[model samples]
Target: MSAKVINITMNGLPMEVYEGMNVLEAARIMGIDIPTLCYDEGLSSYGACRLCIVEIGPQDRTKVVSSCTYRCEEGLEIRTHSKRVMDTRKMILELLVCSTPGSKTIQDLAAAHGVITARFKPEHEDCMLCGLCVRMCKEQMMATAIDFAGRGPDRRITTPFDEASALCRHCGGCMFICPACSSRCMGPDADTTLCSSCLNLSPSCVEVYDHQQCWMPPGCGTCIRPEGDYLPATGRISEVKTEA
Candidate 1:
């Protein structure tokens, strides 16, 4: 085979792809549809969803593979969609939807795959651990404020020390990028006095710092502020006021 040519059979059709190309890209060029959720165009591939599963090799000896992360090799025979592949994809989607019942992304994917209902109860109401938030936080934003705090089913996005993310820049990037957390809400300004019901603070009127302080860089220390502390320079006090 030529250095620039990569021979592969996609869906039983002989295909030639560029060397060092991923299987998903090649299949896409051939107009083969591979359902994917965690595969972004610019970010590194993190095969978390397992929706793009395919069988590669001869019909009798083919093996299941993830098309997103798998590279195309010379003389590789690939089945873009097969009974086993579809069954695996369906099960993966089922589990994901069950884990995140309220997620629009999961619901849409399930509908596309013809999954009417999930077999297992939702492990969680949201957050499928797809890593889009984490990746965007690290790669695009260049901030390691938020991260996967735990392992397996207990995994959750959190800041260091499980407190408010002090290193977070309050950019709201993770909240925006996350498919599970795609919600937009408008509230009073940060300086406005909020009701007790709306304010979930402790007894000391402490403000939970969810991101890195404007004065701090690459550290969470500067973000720490005592409860009832007034803003410096502005002389805004946090005194308890009583209406006459």
Candidate 2:
């Protein structure tokens, strides 16, 4: 038998997804780029990274939810690039960069979302605690070698008893899957936390309209606005296509 499907509206486009599919997977099917640090298709959905957040509900009253964990509901309306969603993503990127300054993954994600500066002081920590390594080890490698220990600032990934675990096969899956393990192009001692070298094109449609018309990976070209038309400096696009 075929899998049951659920219909949802994303970025004004209607799509049918497999039942129990999360918003992040649905958006990805439409070529929408939703940033995520903790999510991997092979492992279970752990909403540790809130980067793939989307705005849901009426325009006047929408709530932000982590797309990775939010299962699609029938007739559910989702805005992937609303003003509120963009703002929330930028803030999350800022915090991620602040926590781990040397992570190329975090820096690239922040630059893509137009987060140029991190206002908070930098901690220069190596790990963001996304738990990809832990999950990858347990789920895929079948070895619960390393796991998080402690609470708050004391929290960290460590082997049992802080010593090497005999259960570990040393398959290197944990380090291989870690985003923080990747180094930035600017090297470790760069004066800045954010490296815009891999910066993506700024999404202009979202600025003109309250939400974006384009949902491509870079999300800069192919806007819904007419080719020759431009919103006046003082005026914005008031018309928005929505789902019922």
Candidate 3:
């Protein structure tokens, strides 16, 4: 039987999506992109990365929810790139950068979300606890070779007793799926906690509205605000034209 359809609003536009479809799925169907790291199509939904968060419900009672794990409901209102949602995502990216300073995936995502710096001390650690490796090994590879152990800051993915697991076929699926496996081309030294080398342009839509008006990247170079001046009310992102 076909799934039931539900009505929902996203980014001020009404969408009819499957009732049990997650926010990410609904967004994907509408050609809307919501950035995510730990939500691979081959794997199950694991909201560990916190990158696909979106603001839901009315302004007075809005709540930030992970799109990968949150299903759409009737009459639900979701804003994928609101000021509050972007702020929360940027904060999460900063923390991820601190945890794994060498991950190219994390670094690129940070730059995309306008995360220029990380406040916490850089751990330069190998893992950000996304659990992709663990899940890949158990579910896809059919070998529970490694599992997360410990708690708090000490938590980690390791074989039982930290010994080499005999069941491991070393098919390299875990390493292949690991987002942190791709290290920054430059070294992750203390001096370079964040590799902003690839950073092109930060979004300026946040300065104008609570949510982004122009969703495109390097969008509307027109809104560059002076240090002591606000943009003229007449100068809007839509007024500026760019080459396609």
Candidate 4:
């Protein structure tokens, strides 16, 4: 038998959706926009980025939950843009902005919420730890070269044991999937504003870019290299050799 449809109230608007449909999907179907950075339709819901959080339950006692992974239920009452939901999202965006002040993506997201500056001292980190690249590497691309390391304040994304792994296929999936760090690359043909300081000095390159290629000789015209060689964003010497 086919699954039964479920009725729910989102932002005071009644709607019907499939029994197992997630709250995010239901909201989208009803034209409710829920901001999300970590929830990609092509990949599993990791819930690492809490930007898509929504307020649930009756007004008396509502709680916040990640709407992307939360399944809809009969008579469920959800508020996608309630004051509480917007406050929580603003707080989350503030934290992300403090860590990644230089990230254009994060900055733009923060600007949308009217957050000019983070109250917390900026940690100067670029990666928002959204885990999209890591999940994409493990589930979609199947490279499994990088993962979360450390705990608490020191926690960060890195290749296994904080070193480049031999398993990386240089598919550039990690860079392509990263929302914050991937903004550096404009595509293969278009030049990017990438600099050697970002490429060699920062951990953002190792975490977001394919780790194997970050340590290799840099020749991409996007940055100033020692040899002045112009290469593609993939940082593949093979491409330079083949073209020559």
- Clash count, predicted structure 4: 0
What is candidate 3's lDDT per residue for 30-146, written digit by digit as tens? 888899988888888989998999999987999999999999999999999899988888999999888776567787788777787779877756578889988898889889988
Full-model lDDT for every candidate: 0.64, 0.71, 0.71, 0.71
Worst 10 residues of 4 by lDDT: 192-201
> What stretches of model 3 exceed 4 Å from their correct place?
188-244
After superposing candidate 2 on the true structure, give the runs of residues whose Cα lies further than 4 Å from its correct spot.
188-244
Instruction: Answer with 1 or 4, whichever has the higher TM-score.
Output: 4
* Backbone clash total, candidate 3: 0
lDDT of 4 by residue, 7-82 (tens): 9999898989999989999988888888888888988898887999999999898999999999999999999988
**Highest TM-score among the candidates is held by which one?**
4
Location of the lowest summed lDDT over 10 successive residues in candidate 1: 193-202
Candidate 1: regions farther than 4 A off: 1-3, 183-244
Report the C-alpha displacement of residue 155, candidate 2, in angstroms.
1.8
Model 1, span 3-45: residue lDDT tens? 6887899987898988788899999999888999888877788
Model 1: colliding residue pairs:
168-212
